[model samples]
Target: MGCILGRHDSFVYPTWHSDPLSWSSPLDSRRGPLPLSPSPQRGEGERHTRRRAPSPEGRGGQGVRTTRARRDGFTRKVLAWYARAGRDLPWRRTRDPYRVLVSEFMLQQTQVSRVQEYYPRFLARFPDLDALASARPRAVREAWDGLGYYARASNLHALARVVSRDSDGTLPAEPEELIKLPGIGPYTAGAVASFAYEKPVPAVDTNVARVLRRVFFGKRETRNGKREVWQLAAVLVPRNGKRAWKFNQAIMELGALICVARKPKCPGCPVRPVCRTGQSPVS
Candidate 1:
């Protein structure tokens, strides 16, 4: 598929409905219990029926209204899948902004499997923003040695210093504030804002955008496809910030596992009802 940028073994590919959560992470019980997640309504396999969805008619008041219903239905299906089948990655278990930041940086065009091994070790060495910020550049780079993108490491370190200095050693929750930091572009900034702060902003990474392309437009985007994808992403996010965080996670996880780039499991996909392409084979 045209939208298939990269697919690594870091994410779980659920083959069975009853499969247990199977993403790896190092133990760090000292971080305390994670915050309770809002429960999404559970969908029981093929028992769920198809529903009417929004059309691709662009930019009108009535069109926007119809789209809202479609997005809500889409959100429910994806979140139910998330609740039932989402990967249990280490970074997902914590709400700490620093941990989220570190994970997001490592995950940029990188595989999840490689990142799971490095995340805790990196955290053990530099437990908080203060620790990362205060460390020497070489030491930080050394810690990030295997992650490949040395520039991300450098920028992450730089961001740590800036955020550590500017905001009482805590990363900012606002996308606007986050973008000013080194290496924190729109995607990273939206990620932090949504994943860390639970803001209802679009975190349109490759995975999320890929899902949107197939579900709404029914094929891989071309030319201005990527740009249009981001705009749609911003529009699709739920207005309720309460659901926003889970919404972002659900879509991304859906893309990563089920609605994947190549050989997508359209038959088992949760959003099949609303997906225009999922109506037929996802090829």
Candidate 2:
């Protein structure tokens, strides 16, 4: 065990022949030392990373392509993809605020498949804000029993009361105004406005964030950069009447179906032409 080595001032010494005073090994023995490689410095191989592209947060919510032309081009391709390949979920078939609100809450933590099981019955029971606001808390909870996250139902009930009593029994058309309702966060408010009222605003959740990162930032970031993702989504949303709503929905749908967290389907991706990691996965 005498072949141990020592490091000092970036220099290495083998205890076998090195001066005992110059270097000492905790397990110094007469067996002789072997050569070793230096450890990698912090971010030493970062240059070899496939995609070191700058995020929108780094460039004031514009990412690499700041021009309106590139942004619009990306938006158009995504919308086209959605038009041809988007899923035909029940939620997409309506513009009713009440129905959209019910769908959004049902979808918050539950999957689309499971939400389908109860959405129809729930909506049938509480057809409007007046109906929901007037219903008992126990009834609402019962409708949401198998759905889990009972708080979403509770909040929805509370929101119904607020809208019915304070705001004419109607959901607000503005995203900001919608946010004041119970259980209506940024995502829900934006979703309600865009999907129901057709407002041109960004409504990002985890899935939307993944698509934005893969398309613009060339990576994935759910936390720590979520606000940045939302800002970027808003910037990228098209202003062509219904185009913004479609664009926001398109990006989220793309993330869920194609640009998934693992094994993204680059071949069928309409925006893959401009994707960094898609172009050079091992760059």
| Winning candidate number (TM-score) | 1
Stretches of candidate 1 off by over 4 Å are: 1-56, 59-66, 220-224
Candidate 2: residue 20 Cα off by (Å): 64
Error of 2 at 251 (Å): 1.1
- Model 1 Cα RMSD, Å? 14.0
lDDT of 2 by residue, 66-170 (tens): 455666778888988999987787888999999989988888756677878898999899888899999999999998999876767777888888778877887
TM-score of each: 0.75, 0.74
On the 0 to 100 scale, the lDDT of residue 212 in model 1 is 82
**Model 2: lDDT to the true structure:** 0.65
The per-prediction CA RMSD against the true structure, in angstroms, equals 14.0, 21.0
Structure candidate 2, residue pairs in collision: 1-29, 2-28, 2-29, 2-30, 3-32, 3-33
Candidate 1 C-alpha error for residue 58, in Å: 1.6
Q: What are the per-residue Cα lDDT tens digits for candidate 1 across 1-283?
A: 2222322212211111121122112111112221122112233234432121223355332122226677678878998888888778888887789999998888876777888889999999999999998999899989999878587777778777776776789887766556556766556767788888887766766688778878877654444455456556666777677588888888888887788878898999999999878998955
